[model samples]
Target: MNKQQLQQQIEQVYLDILIELNLEKVDTYFAPDYVQVTDHITTDINEFKAHLEKLKAVVKSLTIETFKDMLIDEEKQTVFLRYDVIVEKKDNSIGNIEVYAVFTFNDDGKVIACNELTKEYDEQVKGLGSI
Candidate 1:
């Protein structure tokens, strides 16, 4: 796909999946064999879905505080993204995290793999990225 298409897809995923926690749209953006490595911990599609479910249960809202960068390599079907997230829990607690991620899209435009690193903007809120 071209750069604009890739950018739109990624942006939509962030909105529908990460911010909205719409689990039904997971398959639309991710391949069946999707795999992810977050903060050196690896997880497959099932694990990723579970993580989203957990977030959906505890998170009241999630916002992308900043989109620092998005670099796409269309020929290689890869994109790099750097962003900050602000997550508010149901109990009114907030956590901020900064993330840098690289995603690889399959021929069908589904994400096949992702490698990412996240740093807590404040004290160590464990598993803020993958949780």
Candidate 2:
């Protein structure tokens, strides 16, 4: 697929898996041997799914606030994206976070590897404090 197509696919996957918390759709975007590296841990596809499950348990809702930037390197088959997110917890607390992620896709356009960094802001009172 072309760079534009790949970028759209990546965005769809993020919305489906991250924002929607649809673990069942993971295989549509991630390869069987997917690997994820983050500040706290590195995990394979199964482990990543488990991690998402844990997150879902604590988070009541997640929404992407903005797509700050996106860069695609066709030659490297990699895409980098920066975005902001708002997370609502089960206890009704809200948190805003900024994320930078890099995804490497296989020839089939399935994501085989990913690395990300996230900075979470302090909790905010409803309709009050800045993110």
Candidate 3:
């Protein structure tokens, strides 16, 4: 697949992260040996799924607003995406912010890794003494 196709596959998985609790969808999108490297965390495919499961239990839905930035390196199979996310919770609360995201897909069009740099609204509130 080309760079666009690879980004599409990665974006789909991110979109599905909130809508579906089915791990198999992730399994289908991500290579079995996928390795994720985040700003503060690094994990394999299974470990990342575990983190998603925990998130799914608390986050009711995720709304993403993505901007198609430059394809940083087509040859390297990577894309730079900028997005805003609304992380919905059960208590009628929302976590909203924009962040930078990167996704890399394997040769066969499965996402090999995904990473995001996001800011937490609650954490910001805490800094302002509103936690």
Candidate 4:
């Protein structure tokens, strides 16, 4: 596929992953040896899925913004997306957050690696620190 097509595919995969959390069509969207780079460290695909499971407990719902700004690298099969997100909590509270992600895809159009950046959109309510 072309660069734009590859990027769009990865972006759609991510949207599905986040909205559904803890469960994903990994084989369809990612290589078995997928890796992820985060603000803290890098890990394999399984590790990333486990991390998502943990995150799901805290974030009930997610809304992504600025999808049109996504960048793609077809030659290397990479995609970069910078977005804002609204997260819903168990208590019906909501927080806005900013996140950036880089994705690398395999020849099959499956994501093989990813790098993600995240930050709270505002100071945490009740002095919890941040979103």
Candidate 5:
């Protein structure tokens, strides 16, 4: 994919899957063999799905606060993204997290792997980045 298309794909994944918690969109944007490593914890597609499910259960709302940076490496089929997120839990507590992630896509433009790091900007939520 071209740079623009790849950038759009990355943004759409954040909008559709992460912020919206739309589990169905996982199939549309992610490869079946997808894997992710977040904060040194690795998870396969099934585990990823479980994490999302758990997130859905606890989170009342999630917002993308800002896209700090985005870079596309066309030759490597990878995109690097740094963003901040605000999350509100069911109990009405809020937390902020800053995430730096690298996404690698397949030729078909579906995400196949990701390596991510997250920092908790506030103490309201512990381990919020992982789930």
Candidate 6:
């Protein structure tokens, strides 16, 4: 896929899967062999889907506040995105997080792998601060 197409697919994953909590979109956007790596966990497609299901059950609402600096490399079939997300839980507690994610797509334009780094914001501090 071209850069523009890749960008649209990536955005759909965030909008349709994450923010919208539409688990049905998982099969549409991700390859069967999809894998994801993060600092605390590595998950294959099934495991990832289970995790999302759990989140969907517990989360009252989710919003993507910003999706910034999306860069797509057509040659590598990769896209990078920086984003901020706000999530409210069933108990009404809110959490904010910033993330940087790298997504790799297969030739068929389905996401095959992803790696992400995230920083959870402190409700008191507003920004990262020294202890």
Which predicted model would earn the best lDDT?
A: 5
Q: Name the 10 consecutive residues with the lowest summed lDDT in model 1.
A: 121-130
Write candidate 3's Cα lDDT for 4-61 as tens digits.
Answer: 6766665677666545656668877788888876555678877877777776666676
- Global lDDT of each candidate: 0.91, 0.82, 0.65, 0.71, 0.91, 0.81
Each prediction's TM-score against the native? 0.95, 0.89, 0.78, 0.83, 0.96, 0.89
Model 3 has an lDDT value of: 0.65
TM-score computed on alpha carbons, candidate 1:
0.95
lDDT of 5 by residue, 9-107 (tens): 998999999989999889999999999999999999989999999999999999986788998999999999998888899989998888899999999
Looking at model 4, report the run of 10 residues with the lowest lDDT sum: 122-131
- Candidate 1 Cα outliers beyond 4 Å, as residue runs: none
Show the colliding residue pairs in model 4: none
| lDDT by residue (tens digit), candidate 6, 1-131 | 99889988888888899889899889999999999986557889998888788888777887886787788999999999888778787878788778888999999889999998778785732321111
**Which ranking of candidates, highest TM-score first?**
5, 1, 2, 6, 4, 3
Instruction: Report the number of the highest-TM-score candidate.
Output: 5
Task: Estimate, for each residue in 1-131, the C-alpha lDDT of model 4 and write its tens digit.
Answer: 79768866966786778766637566668788998877657788777777667667776787776574688877888888888777777767888767788888778888888887777766542311121
What are the root-mean-square deviations of the candidates from the true structure over C-alphas?
A: 1.1, 4.7, 4.4, 3.4, 0.9, 4.6
Model 2, span 25-130: residue lDDT tens: 9999999999998764688999888878877787888888668899999899999999877888888988887778899999998999999877777645232111
- Model 2 C-alpha RMSD vs. true structure (Å) is 4.7
Scored against the true structure, residue 61 in model 4 reaches a CA lDDT of: 82
Candidate 5 residue-pair clash tally: 0
| lDDT over C-alpha atoms for residue 81 of model 2 | 91
Error of 5 at 115 (Å): 0.2
Q: How close to the true structure is residue 55 of candidate 2, measured as C-alpha lDDT?
A: 74
Candidate 2 Cα deviation (angstroms), residue 28: 1.1
